[model samples]
Target: MFIDAIGTQHNPATDARIISLVPSITELLFDMGLGGNLVGRTAFCVHPKEQVKQVKSIGGTKQVNLEKVKKLKATHLIVNIDENPKELVEELSKLIPHIVVTHPNKPADNIDLFSLIGNIFDRKGEAARLISELQAAQTQAQLSAMELDEKKVLYFIWKEPWMTIAPETYISQSLKIANMITYPQESDIRYPEIDLETGILDQVDAVLFSSEPFLFKSEHLKEFAQTYKVPADKLHIIDGEMTSWYGSRAIQGLRYLSDFAKGL
Candidate 1:
């Protein structure tokens, strides 16, 4: 048996019919050799591209298609505290027997995540291997971070009105391991809209544009630089998944971060 992020009990199941709402966890399921057991996934669960194509899509994280979910007859449903809407999970719980809620707040949190999903799906051996690999990656990242100067960065996630993440988010913690501290160290909201004219850039050593949620391109740098005081050298586009995806990908992400910090 395993306890989920929400303290729900889940026993090991030989007959696990799983449906995942979180993309990272969905990818982790495949890595744990439980891809055959996954019957449904959200539309955003696109990693392991070819294999995930086999799993039927219920819908996106928030707007889940209950009708399609019913047809799949999934015994276990996976959700995330930040990604999946609470009401949606509550509604699905009436039909699905087990709801495994995940909330991986930092890079290291993936350790518990591996044990939680792996043990429940009877893939304890695979989970142990992943845990070992992730730990080794952490050690390597720390060594790399030691050689570089710690930087304060303002990471952009969206651009319509221009949004940035708070320090407490998973993305922030992931970057922190690379010795990149997210600015606005504190915020009233998790994701806050910022004004370019307000001079937040002055406080940050670098300004990063994430390549997801809102695809930040090189062109954005030239356009924004034309108006703002940001230096071209201080701005770079980062692979959003490496910082956001907390799963088997995190092992690779740690390596990516270590490499990314060395170039800085």
Candidate 2:
């Protein structure tokens, strides 16, 4: 028996039919050589493109098709705390035999998640290898961060409401590993909504625009340069997957952070 992030009990079975709503975990399953057992996945699980083509779509994370999931007879349903709403998880738990919910906030959290999933899928060796690789990458990222000068940055996710990553988010943790300090560190909210006129920009050395969730493009940077007093060179477009996803993708993310840190 194993407990998930939400303390849900699960009896790990070697022949469990899995349905993954978390894109990162979906990719992790494929990397673990369990892609054949993956009966269903969310449309967002685009990594391992060729493998995803064979997996059945279970709709989006929040709005999953319960009937379709039931038809597949999934023995394990994987979800994420940040991706799936509480009500949805609660509703699915009653129907699904094993609902594994994961919420990884940092590199250590990701390691634990990998171990848990490895145990669930009966692929301990593969999981260990992935964890080892991630640990090494994490160590390299931290080392590179120490060599770089401290840089204050504002990381933006959404544009319309002007959302930014707070200290509590995984992206903020990645930013710390990249030797970048996020502005307005006093916010209790994980992802806060604020405007540029709030004087937050004055404290930032740079602004990092994510290429996801809101799809911040090059044109937006030009518009921001015209509006704000910050240097145009300080604005950078970063891959959101490298900072946001917390699974096997984290190894690549940490590597990207290590390179970014050395350049700064």
Candidate 3:
């Protein structure tokens, strides 16, 4: 039996009608050759686009469609602590037989994540292959990071309030692999709103804008440059999935971060 994030011991799932609420994990499931078992997924689970389209959509991560979930008759529900809400998961647990809770705090956490999902659904060989590939990518990322200078950076996830990720987040850990240290050094909040007037610009070497959740573009950089003395060249819009997403995508994320940092 494999243990989940919530300490739930799971027996090998057979003929499992799986529903994935976590987006990245949906992709991971497909990678582990369990596409035949997936009965439902959230709207945001868009990776392996052509493959996931065949799977039914329940709803968003937080606002799940309970009626549709029940109709799907999924035996296994895959969720994440950070991406999924507790109350919704609790409600779903009443209907679904197994609630496989996952919490991958860092990039390397994919090792256990891959193993958990694969072993439970009998995809051990595929999981081992992915882990080996991820290890090679990690080495490449390390080499790339060593070539670049370590930098303190401010990563913008939201615009109106100017929200940034905390040091303890997966995004911050991914950036750390690229030799990028996220500032504000706070841990209580995952994403904290920043006040530019507080002289926060003086603390960071560069600022990054994420593409997902918020579609940050060069226009925002131009607007910010008008207000702050920081050079426009130092501000960049990054691929949010490559930095924020975990699971199988994290392999590509690590490589992407390496290339992005090298360009800076």
Give each model's whole-structure lDDT. Answer: 0.91, 0.86, 0.91
Candidate 3 or 2, higher lDDT? 3
Q: What is the lDDT of residue 98 in candidate 3?
A: 94
Residues 16-124, candidate 3: write the lDDT tens digits.
9999998899999898889999999989999898999999998999988889988999899999998888999999999999999998888888899989988999998
Task: Report lDDT (Cα) of residue 23, candidate 1.
Answer: 94
What CA RMSD would candidate 3 show? 1.1
Clashes of each: 0, 0, 0
lDDT assessment of candidate 2: 0.86
lDDT score at residue 84, model 3, on the 0-100 scale: 87
In TM-score terms, candidate 2 sits at 0.95
TM-score, every prediction: 0.97, 0.95, 0.97
Tens-digit lDDT track for model 1 on 1-264? 689998899998878999999999999999999999999999999999999999999999898888999999999999999898899999999989999999998989999999998889888899999999999999989888888899999999998799999999999999999999998888988889988777789988889999988999999988877778578998988999998999999999999988887776
Clashes of 1: 0
Worst 10-residue lDDT window, candidate 2: 255-264
List the candidate 3 regions with Cα displacement exceeding 4 Å. Answer: none
Model 1: worst 10 consecutive residues (lDDT sum): 221-230
